[model samples]
Target: MSAQLFVVATPIGHLDDMTFRAVEVLKSVAVIAAEDTRQSIQLLRHFNIITPLTACHDHNENMVIDQLIGRLKNGENIALVSDAGTPLISDPGFKLVRAAQEHGIRVTPVPGACAAIAALSSVGLPSDRFSFEGFLPSKSSQRLLQLEKLKDETQTLIFYEAPHRILASVKDMAQVFGADRPVGFAREITKTFETIKKMTLAELVSLIERDHNQQKGEIVLVIGGAAKEVDLDQLKLDQLLTRLLEDLSVKAASQLAADLSGVKKKIAYQRALELTAEKEQDKLDRDLN
Candidate 1:
């Protein structure tokens, strides 16, 4: 009833996931700013929501944002909905939301199904401290660069990838994170022919490569973080010990090496002793020669 911006969430796939409150909001609002009016019209028709539709997608949001905000200022309530799922999550409408907030207009959320959250819920990965990295870059170079940056991330990573690029992105992830990294591939979430598989990156790549039918619809990829590994190479440990031995005693050097290399303190201490003894022996042999 109030002249506020209602950010409504629609179903990603299954129409039943559409909320009662979201439908009511759409019915009551004066205008619905949709990502795709054609697809949204079909959705609204299904729910008997005859609200006037307006296109406010990524291509034209910037130009028409002020006009939409002016209508809000003139005491007209508006409902913003995307083609699917929640708007402004790997979707357009951030500009309008920001502009609306700037002009003292209230922006309320009508929360419901989100593909990322839905896929994440059943993916069996750590959900407590997860990062929703919406969509990966389509370009191979940029995508690889982004993956390189995320190589050391310790939290679960969620990504939205297109069907065509899903295999390529998974391949890139396997290359960057190693084949053993756990990946939960959720395809066509909430709709018929939905496939959710949990396995290592290598296994996922193999499955998708063999089954071409798996590469069809929207995909949400949930990848586990890199496991903490304590397998530091002995050569690297000796290198650190040699450098630290120059400035500090064996115990101090060993402790620093243990912290840096993730090796046990006692193990580093013993190695440090060996390196020191070897250095002394070498010096003695050199003097005798």
Candidate 2:
């Protein structure tokens, strides 16, 4: 095979979820850059894939990418995989992919299973319009601030949370989105002890508290969003607009603000125009002074 970088997706829980193409690529590739060599070895052993795995995680990706790129340029096919699910989906590989693209190396995707999509597919939520907010902030305060920003979102919300912090995260969600918001929780999906349940956020919290085992393992939370246009705080709206305005145009910022804060786009558009005018006025005043 010519030199190329393959982005591969592996199983989240069930081994069978690993696709045939993924196994072939893992076997045929010259090198497998795994997020965790030790973990990837287990999967390799299961499939009898003798390919050697090299470490490629967030901390070392930048330092070691040049070496991998050199190997790829020399006609070696390399596959990038995470510990579970898809790489770069709340996982590492962003830097590597960008580097490969920048260097004009062929990048291919060998897709299989993804936890977020798997969980969302089964959950009875409106998937047509949804946002994947993977892995919320680790700290409670930051998590709450993020939840507050997303409180008024109208589309279904998806989140991947760790076991230790699942309870705490759920509590924050309940507080920020209210107790009655409909949500679904999928735990250890596709595994022997897999469980998928849906209920109000309050009830889900109670369930997790009552059953300690439910707190363990991989988790995907699908939350239903605000049913109608929400009354968002002007300060919060402005704060969101300001941050979004940094990279996006006024029209795009307004639309995104509406999607995130559950405000009508037309209203957000007006607000964006006003914010731009204020910025210009402030600049003009400074110039005059």
Candidate 3:
């Protein structure tokens, strides 16, 4: 039988958020692979879990993966964990997970606290459809280019941002998505100083600028998607042409209405002629009465 690779989730903040299953798995695993052994050791000690932790972070994951896999194939169960939250959630451990699967090793997810999902549930934004754009480019220029591309997205957008980059990121969002765009700001999630609030992109920028505290701690940004576009129907187009034809010639009214309503000029002109005849008939009838 192939030993299972348990991918356990640790608490993002409050230690109590750690699940009973996660604790049991950590205690039972032959060894735990942690992003930062030093950081993870503290949590293990708190729970009286003495599972030895080995480093498997971004820098060393490639180097130590083979050794970890070798142990798994030997029928020794291994647990993969990040410094916080679920592994491979904007964290390391993907390569190891992939390698384990490739070797026909069983990979199981022991789920628990995830910062992104926590914020989304309470943000009051459209949760039906969402896009999790894990951290954006650290460079300002690259970040701007990325935001420009997503400006037209029609689903709620989620992004995990670093404390140091919070203010700049919000500012860029406002500039690209417009100051009036609605956004949800969550900082220090599940911690004592946790803050979750919804406001316009402009408001968030001002709050972060004036209050340095808002710039600190683990942050997740939930931005409202671009408003869905409404299509202009033929009836609405004719109404527009009628209004314009009262003050402008047939040619002018058709051209202006087409430009305003995004309709073809030829169609607008034909509609304008029909409206003009209707108006003239109404006038003649009124004169006779």
Candidate 4:
């Protein structure tokens, strides 16, 4: 029988958030595939775990997948972990998991802290329907283009951003989705400096700029969806009636405005009747000319 592959989740910030099962899996696995050996060392040291770890980040993932598979074929259980959060979520390890499955190995998840979920749970935004946009493009033009594509998206949008780029990203969102769009910003989740604030896109931009301290730490931005558009023709009809009441009779104005604005004649005629008495004497004076 082939050995199993375990995909483990590491704490995003707080070490205490690590689950009991996750620790056990990490301790018992024959070898651990880590994104960064240095970061994983600190995590392992906290729990006093001495399991040997090997690097398997984006740079070396393709080269190491076959080797990890070989170990699994020899009845060795392995655990895959990213520097933080869940493996394969904006991280490496998919190839290894797929290879294990192909060789008839069982793949199990040891879930724990995930930054995206942590932010969503407390951001005070609509949770029923939402979309996760992991990270925007680094370039300003590219990022704006990306935002434009999602301008019409009706679902709540979630995004991950680095501290250095948070201000620019928020500004771009404000530009594309209107300044008054509601937004939530979660920073340094699970850590001592954790902060989550809800405000309009413009307000958020000003807040971040005012407080230099707010610019640090990992960021998760949640923005409300677009608002519905009003019917332009309906608005034009009302404007037309108000203008025509000055010179033309109410009945004549209603008929002309209804044809021009494509509004129902009956409704326009009823509104014209309301204005008839107020301007009846004026209509008679205009008719004499």
TM-score of each: 0.79, 0.78, 0.81, 0.78
lDDT of 3 at 111: 99
lDDT of 2 by residue, 1-289 (tens): 3688999999988899999999999999999999999999999999999998999998999999999999988899999999999999999999999999998999999888888998899878889999999999999999999999999999999999999999999999999999999998999989999988889999999999999999899999999988885455988899999999989999999999999999899999999999989999999999999
Q: Write the per-residue lDDT of candidate 3 for residues 1-289, one digit (tens) a residue.
A: 5699999999999999999999999999999999999999999999999988899999999999899999998999999999899999999999999999999999999999999999999989999999999999999999999999999999999999999999999999999999999999999889999999999999999999889999889999999999987655877987898889879999999999989988899999998998899889999999999
List residue ranges in candidate 1 displaced over 4 A: 229-289
The per-prediction CA RMSD against the true structure, in angstroms, equals 11.1, 13.7, 9.8, 10.9
**Candidate 3 lDDT for residue 136:** 98
Higher-scoring candidate on lDDT, 1 or 2: 2
Quick one: best lDDT, which candidate? 3
Segments of candidate 3 deviating more than 4 angstroms: 234-289
User: What is candidate 4's local distance difference test score?
Assistant: 0.89
Q: Candidate 1 lDDT, tens digit per residue, 50-151? A: 999999999999998989999999899999999899999999989999999999999999999898998889989898888999888999899999999998
- The digit string of per-residue lDDT tens for model 4 on 4-52 reads 8999999999999999999999899999999999999999999999999
Off by over 4 Å in 2: 230-289
* Ranked by lDDT, top first: 3, 2, 1, 4
Selected candidate, larger TM-score, 1 vs 3:
3
- The 10 consecutive residues of candidate 4 with the worst lDDT sum are 227-236
lDDT of 2: 0.94
